[model samples]
Target: MASSSISNAEANTNQPRETKFEKLTKRGRENQAKEVTKMEKTRWTSDAEQQNYSVKLVEALSQRSHGNSSPAAEVSHVAVRETADRLLAVAAKGRTRWSRSIVMSRLRLKLNPNKHKKQKKPKVAGDMRSKKPVAVAKKIPAVERKVRLLGRLVPGCRKLSFPNLLGEATDYIAALEMQVRAMTVLSGLLTGTESLAPQFDPLGSGRS
Candidate 1:
């Protein structure tokens, strides 16, 4: 009878310990689920966190076997792959949501007519006092005479007097002489026959 009672006490003591271990295991599983849910939430909000969780989860699975190669390792690898796939899906969903938000914002802006108009005054013929105005020709400035452009001359030579044409011919001759002098200066510089620092004249030396 005493042996039976001792056996019962041992069984009772072991039962509480086993129950505690079971509770601990259950709590661990619950905690793991909570952690996964939290990780999923973060992945939905942030790409960086999603990547980090994927890496961490894979690393945890890989380290579970402690450098031993076996069927257990293969199982761990499979688990890691599955978890990564799920997390990647979550990340993809998040990216899709972000894309939808951007598209919607663009559509809203496009649909707003008030945004297309601004402070620019509209052109109306009734708002103008006259359609055209005439002015007398003025003499070209000395600075303007030295500068030339292809499309700037008045059509039909109307701006030129005989004396102006003579002056233009003189200017053309002067330009030709200046070009010859510039070539001579460049050749002298190339042959190292000219002084390096007399006047700061780049066009004459043809450096450009």
Candidate 2:
């Protein structure tokens, strides 16, 4: 009997205790969902937190870009690609759809600097003042057509439905706002430094 009990205990030990996902009760499930949702909340929702994040983001950009590469590597000075990674980091909360779309698009551009090169402007298709509508253009609903144009503007949203694409656009706009704010703060700091002043003011204007 003692030997049988010992063997049974060993078998139980070998078996995984948490092998199955324990189904939560309805109330438990709701609580669990709330917890999960809270995990993805933006780190900068509060004013204090926003101020903190802005400071950290600028500090990070200064650390990453300072002395890491040659003057030529500052190609992103105009493109602002150097700030892309940090912007993406700030937007990463909740894995929002638009953030993902723009991040992927920008990442592709970052990996292929050639994509950033200015391309020859294509010839204008034709005059835009004509009041006579084309047959195919008349067939499409104005709302639908507008949505399609928005999809083109929001990267990775070509196939998304109108509602989803709007969500993406909203998020993308928010991310862009964050990027602008971050760049503004960083630029303010750099403006005071004499060494980098000329780069910002290539014309040699004393006041930036």
Candidate 3:
């Protein structure tokens, strides 16, 4: 029984212990994570440096603008040189150093920054004289305009032209004339009037 108990103790000792640390990913994944972290740090540094440079540039410009006008040209030259020096100092501390042309270009960009901005053309009343004459809209004839309006009102009138309208009016007048003649004859036949309906008897029975 003691030997069996000793074996059980040995078995407990031989079992693997649980680790406190988490398991790491593969080497490639670890390297990728490290690179991503490094890129983020670099991006943050670059953004901070850019913001610093922009602030310094604005301060320098404001100083130059507020300086004395008696020796304005000289003061501007001094400001440009000072700004260039500051930029060079910052660049030297960074990963990359700017070339002479690049430094000058940056200085010029800061000094003449308006050249990079989009310039809107000033609205001048005089520009109206230079503009091409706007073509006048053709005036629609009154009759044709009325006809088109009528066509919209009446679906059957859509195919009606000027000649068609005139012809339809003529036909309507003729139909009215025929109805009036028929009404007169019917009245004469009922009242036996000789003036409205002359006699038409055969063999000259009702003649004279």
Candidate 4:
């Protein structure tokens, strides 16, 4: 009977210690979770600071339209580069670190500091546009040259193959289009402009 009583007392004492430990661990987790992680905010500098989001986006979208068209035989990078740069500029103005596209970069990479290693870009023949333009033009295949330019157009896609680059370009273009549409609607609402809201036919009625 005495031994049983002592055993019961010991168990009661251990219970509180275990509970205290659990409470401490839970409290630590809660403290860690108190800080929320979000993308870096945009800070507008120089000319961008003066422009509103709608105007900035519209201007950026226009950059792609004004570029020189490429030969019919080859895919052109001019439009892609112009559009990506302008879209990136808008993202920068908002002080957002978009990395490459509108889709957010990985949370794992962001949480882990110094995860990205800077890679040295492979050196290529110097720009021949100013000097021996004809020779330089002949040396690099038209398709290859356009691919390189397309890679540069969309950031973080330097190594992607043509198909992948095309996919990424399409995604970037769609993202920018949506961004422009959203900004236009937002601007209209803010300025009390009776602009007609965009209409989409969710049904197949619009199709033949």
Off by over 4 Å in 3: 1-159, 199-208
- Please write out the lDDT profile of model 4 over residues 126-145, one tens digit for every residue: 75344666766799988899
**RMSD (Cα, Å) of model 1:** 36.9
Best model per TM-score:
2
* lDDT at position 141, candidate 1: 59
Q: How much does candidate 3 score in TM-score?
A: 0.22
What does candidate 2 score in Cα RMSD to the true structure?
Answer: 12.4
So what's the TM-score on candidate 1?
A: 0.19
Q: After TM-score superposition, what is the CA distance of residue 58 in candidate 1 from its true location, in Å?
A: 65
TM-scores of all candidate predictions against the true structure: 0.19, 0.52, 0.22, 0.34
- Winner on TM-score (2 vs 3): 2
Question: Which digits, one per residue and each the tens of the lDDT, describe model 2 over residues 31-84?
Answer: 988986664344334333444555556555556667567644543454346455
For candidate 4, the per-residue lDDT at 145 reads 91
Q: Rank the candidates by TM-score, best first.
A: 2, 4, 3, 1
Q: Write the per-residue lDDT of candidate 3 for residues 1-208, one digit (tens) a residue.
A: 9999999999999998655442334565788889965753453234234334444554565577777576554445566656645553344343221223345556678899877688788889767765656453136677877877655443233556766554434433333343344335434654777686533321123443
Model 4, position 103: C-alpha lDDT score = 30
In order of listing, the candidates' clash counts read 0, 0, 0, 4
Off by over 4 Å in 4: 1-134, 199-208
Note the residue pairs that clash in candidate 4. Answer: 41-95, 42-94, 42-95, 43-95
Which scores higher on TM-score, 1 or 2? Answer: 2
Ranking by lDDT: 2, 4, 3, 1
